[model samples]
Target: MTFTLATWNINSVRLREELVCKLMTEEAPDVICLQECKSPVEKIPVERFQALGYTHMVARGQKGYNGVAILSRLPITDAGGRDFVQMGHARHVAARLDNGVTIHNFYIPAGGDEPDREVNEKFGQKLDFLTEMRDLFHADKPQRSILVGDLNIAPREDDVWDHKKLLKVVSHTPIEVEHLVETQGAGGWVDVTRADIPDGRLYSWWSYRAKEWDEADKGRRLDHIWATSDIASAGHGSRVLRAARGWTQPSDHAPVFATFDL
Candidate 1:
């Protein structure tokens, strides 16, 4: 079986429900994993998405904060979620397709303006969350699985527009990058995005603060897609829907996509 999958930090699924429908109508990926939905599971506007043919969903949500959801045209079974660092945030969820492929969706903490954990409690939480992720995957080891979401860390120099300028910035800091590398290594996950498009300055997130985001192009590859070694070879066609970031009332992040043949 072959399927195309997309991961997006929708920011607020209810507020941008129309944009979600727009992408569903236009791109039509088989599955879409969403982060930061900011709505309780019952209020995700499922009827609207179902009208666009995304009939199956598995999600974890909070009333007006963090949330994660997977909407699919292909059938999938809920695979549960984990609250890393015991933050009790709706940051992770998983689903399994009939093809025996499990998809894990996550919304890692964005650390905060300051990178120093001593002064920023959120920064400390971010580091702790990542550490737990590394330990979980290290103990169990994933197989036939794909992990995707707004991981909130840009691990490569090329992933940011100005690597030197952003090194002190939250997402591109060396400590955060090291933590992300450890998490990926623990799972033996291959970064499907870089594996396919190995060069150039690729970005999925352009800050809303930019006066003209595209023209300024000060962006970072904060979102990601990764697959375990068992099916990493089957993953291909990685790309980011950059234009979506320019849409009316858009999310700072755009959708990242990949296809898998298994």
Candidate 2:
């Protein structure tokens, strides 16, 4: 079976429901994993999505905060788990499709302004979250799994428009890069998006802070799609929908896509 999956940080789903509907009509991915939904499960406007043929969904949500949701046209079972390392937030959810593919959706903490854990408690929590995920992946070793989300880090120098300038920035800080590498390595996951766009710079997020974000084009690879090596070859057609950033009332981030021939 071949299916396409997309991951996006919608910022606030309520504010972008029209964009979501547009994506459904245009891209028509089999499964759509979203982060930062910023709404409770009951208030997610599921009927709007349901009308678009994504009749199934599994979401972990809180009022006006971090939320993760998965909507699929295919049959899916909520594969819930204790986000033990990063509990107390609506930041993770998983679903198993009838095709035997497990999709892990996440919205990892956006470790506050200061990168120093000593100064910022959120920074400490972010590090702890990464550490916990690393330990869990090593212990259980997720198989036949595809993980996707707004990871909030740009690990590679090429991923940013101004890599040299962003060295001290939170997302590109050396410590955060090291942790991201360590965690994903422990999971034995393949960077599906990078595998497809190997040479040129690719990014899924541009700051809304920029005076001319598109003109200046200072962006980060905050979002990602990864797969276990077992079916790595099946992942292709990877793309970062950058044009969406130009849309009226757009999210600071764009969606990333990948297709799997499983």
Candidate 3:
């Protein structure tokens, strides 16, 4: 059977529930991992999504801050949320599907604009978060696992619009990239997107600060889908729904998807 999984940072669930439903009906991913939900679990508008045929959900959310959720049509078990140093934010949520595949959704810190750890505390926290993640996952090294969400780091030069110009930028900086690489190496996680578009300018996120983000085309591939090496071979087609970024009242990021022939 072929299963499709998607990752998207909706920014806020209550505000974009309609758009989420629209995407669900249009794309029909078997599982959708979301980040930055910005709403409590009860306020996530679950009924609307359930009405659309998604009956299973595992989410960790705050009032209006960092949050992550997994919405699946298939049954999900072992639902758990990571505290990550008691940070008091809903940043990580994971579940195991009946197919025996585990899914982890994360919303790593944005690391602020400063890019300097001393100046920006968020940057320091972001690096520490990556370190913690590396340590946690490397211990077990899951085989039938998939990780997805807005990781907030662009690992390759081509993953950004202009790598040279954005070298100083937080998302594309050397330090951030190194941290992400370390995490990937620790977990032996193969980037599903890279399995297809090996070399090219691929981006999943655009800053809302732009007057015309599409015209500017200044974007960063902050979102990602990763699979354990054991099941990485199952990864086939991967795509980014770039046009969705232009939808009315759209979020700054678009949906990234990958299909696995399990």
Candidate 4:
């Protein structure tokens, strides 16, 4: 089976339902994993998506905060989720496709402005969340699985517009990078996007703070897609839909895509 998958942080699905439908109409990926849905599962407005042919969905949501959902045209069964760091946030969900591929959609906690855990509790939570992820993946030893979402960390120097300037920043701090590396190692996961586009200043998220985001071009590769090593080679056609950021009332994030032949 071959499928195209996309991961995006829609910010708020209800507010951006039109954008979601537009992507479904335009890009038509076989499956899309969404983060930061910001609505209860019951209030997700599934009918709108179902009308667009994405009838299958597995979602974990909250009232006005973090949420994650997987919408698929292809059949999938709920594979469950986790409450990492015991934060009790709707930050993760998983589903298994008919072909036995398990997809995990995540919305990792964004460590606050300060990098020091002593000064910032959110930073501590973020580190703890990554630790839980590393522990879980190491214990379970995932295979034929893909993990996608706004991981909230940019591990590579090139993943940031100005690496030196961002080194002290929350997303690109050395500690966060180390945690992410350990998590990837624990899962034995391969970064599908980097594998496909090995050399470049790639980014999937541009801050809305920029007055002219496109012209300023300050961005970070906080979103990611990863596959277990066994099937990593089958992944290709990786891309970030940057133009979507310019859409009407767009989210700061742009969808990241990867196609797989399994």
TM-score of 3: 0.98
RMSD of 1: 0.6
Query: What ranges in model 1 sit over 4 Å off?
Result: none
Q: What's the TM-score of every candidate structure?
A: 0.99, 0.98, 0.98, 0.99
Q: Give the TM-score of candidate 1.
A: 0.99
lDDT (tens digit, per residue) of candidate 2 on 1-262: 8999999999999999999998999999999999999999999988989999999999998889889999999889999945645457998999998878789998889999999999999888888888888999999998999999999889998998888888888888999999999999999999999999898888899888986888988889999999999878899999989988988899999999999999
Lowest summed lDDT window (length 10), candidate 2: 81-90
Worst 10 residues of 4 by lDDT: 81-90
Off by over 4 Å in 2: 84-87
lDDT of 3 at 63: 96
Model 1 lDDT, residue 148, Cα:
98
Please give the distance, in angstroms, between residue 128's alpha carbon in candidate 4 and its true position after superposition.
0.4
Which tens-of-lDDT digit does each residue in 81-135 have in candidate 4? 9988877899999999998999999999999999999999999999999999999
RMSD of each: 0.6, 1.0, 0.9, 0.5
Residue 48, candidate 1: alpha-carbon lDDT: 94
Candidate 1 on 111-132: residue-level lDDT in tens? 9899999999999999999999
**Model 1: residue 235 alpha-carbon error in angstroms:** 0.7
